[model samples]
Target: MNTSDLKTKIQNLYQDILINLDIEKIDDYFAENYVQETDHDTLNLNEFKDHLQKLKDVVKSLSIEKFNDMLIDEQQRSIFLRYDVAVEKVDNSMGNIEVYAIFKFNEVGKVISCRELSKAYHEELEGLANI
Candidate 1:
């Protein structure tokens, strides 16, 4: 896929799949052997789907506030994005987070693997003393 197309797909993956919590459409974007790595754990496609399902059940609302940066390297078949996200739970508590995600796409343009690192609002202030 071209860089533009790859960028669009990455954006849609977040907006249409993650923000919308459309578990049924996961296959449309991810390869059958998709792998996801996070700070704590790594998951295959099925496990990742289950994680999304759990998030859908627990979080009342989710939004990607800004896609701050996107870089596509066609030669490496990789895409990177830095984004801000906001989530609100059923209890009305909310948090904003910043995330950096890297995706590797298959030849046909499906995401074969993804690695994400995120920092919550509070996590960014770990060394601060006064509130």
Candidate 2:
């Protein structure tokens, strides 16, 4: 697929899958063997779902602020995205943090694997809560 097509896929994942938590839509987008590398560690499909469920349950309001500088390598079928997210904790505290996520697509255009690393700012929020 082309860069534009890949961009649309990521955008849909952000809006429909991540933001909306539409599990039905996920099967259509992600490969059966999809993998996730998060700040906590690496996780396979079931692990990823469990982690996402935890995030969805704990993080009250989750929103992506910006996605910029998306570079796609058609040869390698990989996409690199630099973005930031705004999240409100269950305690009603809000914070924004920078993040980077890389997606590797399979031959059929499904996301085979994804790796995401983000700045840990939850501590900062807790500190502010005390102040």
Q: Which candidate is the best by TM-score?
A: 1
Top candidate, metric lDDT: 1
Q: On a 0 to 1 TM-score scale, where does candidate 2 land against the true structure?
A: 0.86
Per-model CA lDDT versus the true structure: 0.80, 0.75
In candidate 1, residue 37 scores what lDDT? 84
| Model 1 pairs in collision | none
Clashes of each: 0, 0
Worst lDDT window (10 residues) for model 2? 122-131
- Compared with the true structure, model 1 gives a TM-score of 0.89
- The C-alpha stretches of model 1 lying farther than 4 A from their native spots are 122-131
